[model samples]
Target: MQKYLSLLVLACLLAFNASAQQLRLITGTVKDSLRNAGIPNVVVRVKGTDFLTATDAKGNFKLKVPAGAVTVEAIATHFKQKEIMVGASQTTVHITLNLLQPLITDSEKNRYIMDDKKGLSEVVVTGYAAPRIASGIHIKASPQNNTEDYSPINENIFHTATDQPLSTFSIDVDRASYSNVRRFLNNGQMPPADAVRVEEMINYFDYQYKAPTGKDPVAIYTDMAVCPWNTGHQLVRIALKSKQVDTKDLPPSNLVFLIDVSGSMDEENKLPLVKRAFKVLIEQLRPQDKVAIVVYAGAAGVVLPSTGGSEKSKILAAVDELQAGGSTAGGEGIQLAYRIAAEHITKNSNNRVILATDGDFNVGPSSDGELERIITKERQKGIYLSVLGFGMGNYKDNKLEILADKGNGNYAYIDNFEEARRTFVTEFGGTLFTVAKDVKLQVEFNPQFVQSYRLVGYENRLLQNEDFNNDKKDAGDMGVGHTVTALYEIIPTGKNSPVVNWVDPLKYQQAKIMGNQAEVLTVKLRYKEPQEDKSQLLQKVLPYSRQQIEQVPEDFRMTVAVAAFGQLLRNSAFKGTATYEQVLAWAGKARGEDPEGYRAEFIQLVKKAKLLDKE
Candidate 1:
């Protein structure tokens, strides 16, 4: 027994030594060989294993790998992936990638180079449920962007009307997702499922809802119909119409354009496009408006002193002269821009910092928590932020969304010149001015009418029911001309439906509920004046639907079509039998005059999606 014990100890020691010998520390920097700039957010993974890490702001990465003849692959969006071998003796390595296409390529078309090491890895699919194809996108049951940041979608579940009936969420007016999805489609690729936000897509286009006619700043429009996607389910549309402020009534502006000229922003879709976009905005500014140019790349500094907006040539030249280079130092840039805005801000003035970036906040206050706290603190001083996201691939939507949410602002994704015009030119007042802040909504569904219900597309914007009255909590801000639309799919009582996730009947509550015969829901809205702490309240009671699906209004039909399109892009489990053909048919009929051609453009997008999805 003693001899066997000694042999066992020796065997264990040998095994431990072998394992240690196979492990190695790997370090490297990922860079673009042509430009010789470090690439941040590139995924560094050991093939056939779970070990992974991403390159930092400087494109430097570190990883531990099993050292004997192991393969290391670097993955990045739009950049050609590369693979290299690290032997037992190797201590450090370097990876140089060829950018498939620069952000500012000569051609407007996307030409992503395909290679074995370039496509999304197998790991992406296993995070969620089994893969489901959405359009051309291969969606994993769970989607993790590997190196990039994206907030996960926690699909809301149906709540039994008897168990818990209140549904509340912050109103989201940010229309970033629509243009972001359009970016993918125009590039001939499917957008990541998380990028297709249903509410934003529906809110992007203008609808002919009647504006507020009374003293109220906002009006409510409600409609209901049998859901086209799931016949047994009912779709409820709740929309808000805010009074539009004419340009002449708008207050004088103090604008600071905080531009990112980081190396990653050097592409045609980035810095160059930004200059052009800002030029368009410059053309719209009035003589009373003041504009300042501040840029960041490795460091932050003011490029142009505060100039009167009437000097269009000076502002245009300042923007055109700006060039892209160096590393991203977003936190530093933000501080300087806010400082500039503070100096120029006047009482009742439109003081705002227009942050243009790809959401790469590499240096200082970069993380979500840190940035959120800092930006939130800054907004208390009456300095607002409006984030204009540009470019793709390394785009950090999650981070920019945080900045906008915390900074008392809105966000928009500018994919091209047309979108830039739409956001900066056509919607100038909506883009810059704010009428209401901390807007929140709560709906109390009547137990006598509703069996179960689910709110669509505000997954990330959902708020606690009690938060409706909480004046301290921050919520979405409403722009001067911004309109918000929300939808809920309900299961009526006394109906047999699979979606009605029936729980065991309560043993204690035998009492029946008494409610108004016409009231289906009571929606309450709370909002604060842009400068005030206290909130004002608005309420409206919705009656049971009087219109059938075939007779629904055009706005309702168009909204339904857009919402369905978004769900299809997300591969929503709730979108039962919702086909692209149906989406097309419903949207085509709802196409109004579309003077701006936005609705017409949406119809064309649906056709493109149908072709791409082979539906």
Candidate 2:
């Protein structure tokens, strides 16, 4: 017995030693060869394994890998992926990646580049060279082939205050448009006019608005400044800041990852990016939280049953196993995911179905109206839906927007891994946890202080004035740590404007001026608690304290700059004197306390847009 025990211990020790010997600590830095600058957010992965880590802001990464002949791969946007083989003795590596040059196409026509390594067909501007198609690769042809969808937006026209006193809209917290527009500008293409939602663009950055000190979940703030675009007009900025919740204080989450593994998702930025993004979210989960994964291709089915977040390896494995193939059955997948969420529903828990897709629903109940109806019915079960749109070319923004709006959730477009980090890490609480639902805003302009007003953006979120008081009416949801902003360009009561043409005195009943003379406008907000059916009302009056554009707060100025940029992108008729140069100047001055560098990146994007506009 003693001899047997000694042998067992020896055997275990030898096995442990062998395992340790097989592991190697690898460190590396990835840099742009042309610019000699470190590349950040580059994915460095070990081939044939799920071992991957992104480079930090300085392009440095460290990971453990199995010893022996190992293949290391580095991938980043706008850079050609590269792979290197390391021997068992190798402990450090330096990788250099080449930037992809824009294709010079003839007649300004669309050009394609085949990324064989990622099995992706990337679209680029104006190229004459023949596309190099990989052998043995079959690209599927479907009804929704290579065409992106966006809902048309007719820019808001000036409304006379006496003729139309109330301007109502749902508060949009979704920042998908900014990232989507970034994607277009990054790819050297001008985005469609409808894709530029100015309200969303303005709401993308964090603003240091005052936190709620009352019982309400959101605090309201108003700022009045000389309009940067139209000097004769004033820009009224309405800001709402939701209460912040720490990660440790958040409720236990019951999450269902509804992933679209359709053929259209085969691109590197689609299925692979989805898997990587979910991994980021999975790391944020606690033992008390649970996650279930449901993938849809030709049919909808569960890849992993509801499992505790402690079993992260298992959930990650399920996500990694998902592959893109067959047709999309998005509607069926939605039903299955919501059913799982409902079954596991608990009181005071954060229950949500996160749908990751390119928004291509071809096989089952694919129309926007049909999917909207299905989501509308499912949302009543207390299960919210969050749509993370992936990929381009065939992206269906219109459908995704509708699903999120009607399903009482938020929509975001994940154009790259950095965006994935922002969505899942920096804004984790705001992305997955909802604090208030059906949040609507109704602004009553004081005819005494304002002549005509126009909502700067949010064309799609505009609601009838009656809908503000309707408890059953669906609207946008406000998440923890969310900052929502809306800008209204107003021509002061006596200012004559080219845009605002007064009708020869109202033939019908004219609105009586009754508000305080010192007030610019009265803003009313309605919202419901996450688990409540009834809505609560909050109101605030914007005092007529107009400040010069230079004297307003930095946040107010930054938001105005963003709105102007959006209008420039859309080429709106009301974009009075709003040049890209003006946007750059205002944004440069107001780009304050950008810890995340989002504002700096916005400035860079504006520079790019200026060049593109000239082209």
Candidate 3:
């Protein structure tokens, strides 16, 4: 028995020594640099081996490694992979990961870096320049210096102590914006092989109108009858007319043009396109308008100081000299541009900084919070901002939209030359001129007529219930001639609708029946005068079951189809009774006399997109 015991002890010791020699244990914690929080679900794998393990909820990871030196890799979605080496017997390791890329669709892949060698083949070309005829309305849409009567008193008031009054405003969606989308989808092609920016698609139509020329403080107008293809629904047109002002407008102007000249901007659709767009504005500027240009690449710099707008040649030359290279320093550029604008701020005229980019701000101030802070601080200087997104691929739509909202600016995506011309030339007045600020829309459903509804699009624009009345809260900016659209899908009361999913009844409670059926949707608009700190309210009501009105007009139906297409592109959850074929059929009926051939182009785009979808 004693001999057997000795032999067993020797065998156990040998087995323990062999295990220690064959394997080594490794442990570590993975954390995010900015958030300083553990990143769970990170995969840790032994390089060149099948062994793998994931981090715990607390970001702690452990792995047994083979005896010799080995490489351990860590990977997570939306973050760059990280690797570390472990010598034999190495015990603990610590790691920090900084996310390198943003989450976007494949359509936005090559947006940030310019591929000059590829030339202009990637760009979408449009027809001859059709000069816009000013309809005898005395308005200045470009940045300029003048003491014009049109300037509002609150122009320089960033924050005011007085109780300012708010007013109500309404927006009619543009039917033309969706024309191409409808046509393209109807023909079963991808909505133009080119990029289809959803914002431009919605902003292209002109709705009905009641001139603000007199009676009401605010009135809207549209000419839906002009389109031959409209069918099924009534089109509500709202035209925002500019306030009349002479050359000696209200105040001198301070303008900062923040441009992105990163490596991604080397393409003709980016840098060259931007230069051309600005040329249109430079020609329209007056001497009183002070212009400055700030550019960012590997670093940020003020390329041009505040100069007279009349020096069009100099500004154009400066624009032409720009070459794209290096990384993006968007955060730094914002800081510098704001400082320059504030330094030369005019006491009366419009003071604003316009940022033009592909929405790719990769290097500094990359996080949402960091960029938000920079924009929020600049807002305090009474300088408004406008974001003009250009190019595609790596386009940070989510970030651009957020920055624009926080900075009290409007956001528009330019997918082609025509779009650039529209924003910077044809509708220049509405694109740059501010007619209303802090515009908030709240619809109080008549619970008696409607059960529940969901707002389509504008997910990022959602506001809290109390934010509607809070005068201090900043909202969307409405430019002269600009129109905004919001839509809701409602489930009427007492209807056996598939749209609604009933919830379980409360304990000892009976289902409540809606008592009245008079009201339908009540739209409340609250806004501040262009320059004011106070807000005013406007109310409009649509009664329940107006057979005449609910019988959607041709133009309205066409717009609905366009909206449906947008919802489809975004993969929205609220899309109901909307299909590509149905949308195409509806659009085909509304293609009225499209002289510019835009409708035909849309049909082709839709067909291509559909094929891609199938593939």
Candidate 4:
């Protein structure tokens, strides 16, 4: 048998009902020996056996070990592996794991150096992550930061604009990636490539796109320009702006705060930050609005029943008194939150469950598929969900991504008090009120003006071309005042760029003749009112006109710059010589308004990322 010399186990016995005689449920909490905080995602299993289970957010586990099993092993990502023995009659045990410092190979040692200027230093993994550097590095990450999961981004390939004239996708208003990436950067680490969503980064700051003037609630804008990286190619920009709604005019809200206070959240950044964030949001609630608080740990329960937002002090007290120290039961919390929302749901109101967590749902129904299925069924009842991410270690980006994407909601990451302010105070209306749902976008390129083209970013937001007109299909949700942007890199016709994929010309027939027109592509948008079944269609035709790169709106160029930065981050196949230097240059020139200073902050981030770029 394999040996683990570090196992430290504690055992205890409790009474059980006679009906439980058929199965012995082994339940316990796992924790780190250093800080005594619960360790998440620890593998818990019967030693030398296939029977196994993993520890949840609070480092808790419940396993149905066979009657004869006595020895169990616990293994965590950055902790020393351990094995512990259970007492003959014990049904519960507590296991603690000692931290394991990674063996520093000569190659790895060369990649990382202590930055005296910063309190904590970045450990650069040459190939897997970005070059990390500088300051507070407060994501408070252990070696476990690198273990978080994110969906791989598959860069779209170029298609002959003639052969595939349609570029269809869902309009994404989710800015989770931008804040998430900022968390890593502020922590002196380059965020994982997949965590950098270009479109979200671009849409993070407000743009000057004109709001809708017609009966439709959304407006579309498009512009084409010479690609900065390769002058031979062109870049197309598309923007969608939703009409702004006055806070007082917005429908009364029915909000449920679904919080995860598992033992993993006991950290300063997790539960503590979450409570403060909810308090900030409480300040924005109107008299007509109602709020409820539901928290989950080893079990789920309501700390505060549905009450008028005017009772702010009572709500704040409930939030302040929350303590974290149990396994996470995310599924139960979600269900209970939905049930609470459903009970007091007001027709036509902004009904939503605001979930704040680190995305470590390790207990029942923890998998993305299971959580998504649960949220999907609940959303049909008219209750939307907004996932607010917190903290870093064991953060499951993919799980939150799926939850927000499938839950008819938006997602945001709360890194610090400032982000919490931005999400709750500055963007209150958009964060809580949805103006349009099932929003979809489709674009058609005139083969005459453009050759092969590739849609930039939106890798996770792409929809099947056929799903565009299908009203039954669930796509994305857009909130009041939200803006969605998409970009396309095109190889203009007759340039014969070698970058595009090749397909043989048809052997049987002649192609359509080109007309002498400046038209490039047309933009089409479909959206339904929050509670409507039918989608309203809106269209705008974009002509192919060469403009002095200087003439394009400053906001348009800024978005372009952000997209380029993302491409550089991902080392995308189509980035074509784009550099962080170029991104900084474009962003600097386009830095216009300073109202919120978001654009200015973005420029600083670019500077930080450039230093972290090994390439």
Candidate 5:
């Protein structure tokens, strides 16, 4: 009886101790400068413990802490970190952190921070975020050179012809505001937003490219129609198709893959997705192809030396062994991969380096100048590079684009498995094979036929007018089956639209008369042979009526809607008459004949976004 009583007493003591060791529940919402607006995916860490939590879709986080005073830290990309001390009895806490200005201000005494009051004056609402003003960075367009072949088919389509060029050009419009709004919506428990990249959104749909019915080098087609918003403008879509090249037809390929296995890439969307994407590419490789894999994180090393494509199991096994950790040494990895590719250089065959990363190069040679120098030097060795960007949140789009541009390669952003398949499998030739390097488009608007114009997208790809004909200046590359599209929004001379008021009148400049009104725009494309430095030009004229081309097919309209949606997400000034509902309608109408069900999936995404907005 005494033993039983003792056992009961011990049990009671254990229960009391367990209950007294209190666990406090804390809850809070993270916000930006204005307050109350939640920030999503903010990383929260407890100072002394390994415990961490990310804000939910609603920007809310809940954590349990031991019964003692502790410090909580919250960090996010582009935003300042917030830290707070919690007392032993404090069960809940709230915090707000403001986004840091990307630009630095020069003060008389020292470089310091400036409020965004003046910056906010430049905001133009285009449906995504609030307006953002220009960053005071001046982007000069190439001067009008009289060289006939070097001139753009139409200046209005490719250049700003108006005095208020900033107002007309979407590239100069505010993007930070749009991005901020998007972050808010995405964190506010809103459904996955349909913020497809303008370029990718348009490129996702397969336009009708004349397939080689008979023997031909390649087949190409283009569709030009009036932009829905502005009847005075047109959108040009180009499609190129190459004859299927089987494994036997493919030349021996020496391939080097440069991968980032940094700690930031620990998420499933980063390293795991990269492995899966590469696996697809491996399956499509020919037996003659040789592949080498290089990884960078704190240090760079060759994980897998040159191996035959036929040895699929061996390559995949090496891939499976990869795990993400450590800081990114992207420069070291690039150098090592280039060395391997140069060592295995094959004459008259495919030699390339493929870079896969989230573009966070924090550990070594992370500066833009250093990275560009490395890539530029490597490109001179007659080896091409391709950049595949993965993951988000901490993504570096600017850096990735620069690398591909200077490396004589192409750039792609993979948001999911479907994009992976599309880039690696469906469009392998364009993604892997290069046809032309340093492709530049320059347009010369005939002052006689046009008034104001703006080029859409390609904000970072602009070049000097002299650079167009320099041949030495590098530009974008074109793959075997790749298609590049550019859009323009125009305001005709006669239109009385009051989009922007000119600060000063150019009364001294005489308005030119229109000799021929038939031609609305002209396009000039210059490209160089992959191995050559000189470029060849292709020119085409689009008529004015084509600018008003209507009754576009549902598929084509859907494609435009996708691009428009992207512009809206970017808060582009050119996004006139493009609404979320309109985008949804177009997507729904074109969700037919989806053999892979990708279109259906996009439709569902749109619906989800709509439902979230209702909520």
Candidate 6:
């Protein structure tokens, strides 16, 4: 018996030693080939196993995997996924990923063919194939049942500064338009004119403006230079940056993920992508934070009750088990989510309902007006709404924008996994945490120095002149670390401008130049604290400058490129000489320190646009 026990012990020891020898620590770095910079938040996984880790801020990662020949995978947002094989003796590895090139999928080609409503018949070109034309450009058309909706935008016309000196609008922080347009471009089609919101595209890239130095939570910066599109006109760039909150200082959150699992969401990019996006947000939650999963299809139901963030396993399981089917009852789902949020509302906590959907509400008060009324009423209860639009064919951009606007919230369209990472991981605070509510801007131009001016973009966000000061009127909200950018093209006094029409001199009242000659404009802003009912006022005076466009900051030039790109896409009457080639040139030069490669991606989009325009 003793000899037999000794033999068993010897066998067990040999097995344990072999197991230990099979494990090895692997260290590696992930890099972007285009920018030659390390990429943060990249997922490194040992293929065919559950061992996974993420790169740190510097793109460094370490993980233990079985020794001997093994396969590894690296994945990141906006970049192509890559795989590498490691030899038995290797302990260190390096991986480089290329940026994803836009490709026209079969579904994208079919969307164009199905859209007979866009005045496209069954006409075929001699050189083009059934689905793809040369250079991968597909003939632009909407699907017959596309059901996609965009609000019509009448381009803002040049205003006579002497006749209308004040331009008032709400500060919009939503950047859905940029991503939506990107989706269209990536699909090898041009987006409808109404889908290109110029201000949103300009605000999409972070300008890294200086944060607030005063007690206020927001800071304003102004710059003026010769307009690139129209050399005769000067462009005024007004930027507002909100104070950044440290991760440790972020308030505990009470979040309800209102996910749409309707039949329309059955596509891989719809409900599945939403689940993946929510997982990213889940990774950011703290022990004090709580999240609930509320899903809607035929009806709304809670798959998981309010659970502490520490129970991530439980939450993830609930999310993974969700399936998509049935008609969308978005209104019911919203009501349930808000009720759940209100029940667990914690004082001083960030309470919000994140609605992830394609904005297809087929049943129960789905009209834009009805939905807006619902969101507006719920917003008064201290529960904010953030809309995350997913999918494409039947995307209801118009309805989603209205829900966000009325709910005092922000909206984003997640077209791919990279965008999902950007929204939920890279921009966690700005997408979810509100810093200032009811933010409004009023620019009063000096007629002495300006002949005519036009506020670019922000057609829907325009507010009445008196609405700027009315505390009761609700406006847009700014999130933590959010930056709002606005542009105004001004024709300097005595300059020949094609957009401006001469009018007879005022007969009854003579115009007088009362303000300082150097004062080009006075910008008045109003904002309310997230929990406050009353608003606070802030103002700044802009001094005139003759700075040329070439002398301005790289960020300013980058914004000009984006704005011009937007105008060209929209075919604006006031686009002047803006061309896709010019946009590419300006953007290429201004792609500074593009660690995340967003600006670089913008340049690629311009290249695609230039090619598609030729088609």
Point out the higher-scoring one by lDDT: 4 or 6: 6
Q: Could you give candidate 5's per-residue lDDT for residues 1-615 as a string of tens digits?
A: 999999999998887667546555677777766335666656565653433455664568876565688898876543556689988888777888764433334345332332433222111111113212121111111112111010011111223244432221111111111222233344433311222245545555554455545433234344567777555455655444444555466567889989999998899889999999999998988888999999999999999999999999999998989999999999889989999999988776788999999888987788889989988988877887888877656666657767877787766766667667877888777677766667766665544444555665544556766677777787766565555555555545442322122123356555653545566555566667666777776665655545333366655666776677666544343465676787777777766577777566556555544554430
RMSD of each candidate relative to the true structure: 16.5, 26.4, 20.3, 20.6, 23.9, 26.8
CA lDDT of each candidate? 0.78, 0.81, 0.57, 0.77, 0.61, 0.81
Model 5's number of clashes is: 9
Model 6, backbone clash pairs (residues 3+ apart or across chains), number: 2
Clashing pairs in 5: 123-131, 142-465, 152-442, 152-443, 153-522, 153-523, 154-522, 155-444, 155-445
Off by over 4 Å in 4: 1-146, 506-516
After superposition, the stretches of candidate 1 with alpha carbons farther than 4 Å from their true spots are 1-148, 495-499, 502-515
TM per model? 0.77, 0.76, 0.63, 0.77, 0.66, 0.77
For candidate 6, the TM-score is: 0.77
The predicted structure with the larger TM-score, 4 or 6, is: 6
User: Please, what are the lDDT tens digits per residue for candidate 2 over residues 53-96?
Assistant: 56765678876677687898886644566899988889999999
lDDT of 6 by residue, 1-615 (tens): 999999999998997677667678788898867436666656677764434566765678877777778899886533467899998889999998864342222453443232122232221111123221111122222454456766655456567777678999999999999999999888777776668899999999988899998889899999899998878789999999999998779888999999999999999889899989999889989999999989999999999999999999999999999999999999999999989999889889899999999998998878777788778888998889999999988888888998888888789999999999999888899988899999999999898788778899998889999998899999999988999999998888852232133233357545567868899999999999999999999998999898877799999999999999998887564577788888988998899999999999999899888877642
Q: Residue 47 of candidate 6: its Cα lDDT?
A: 67
Q: What is the Cα-based lDDT of residue 575 in candidate 1?
A: 66
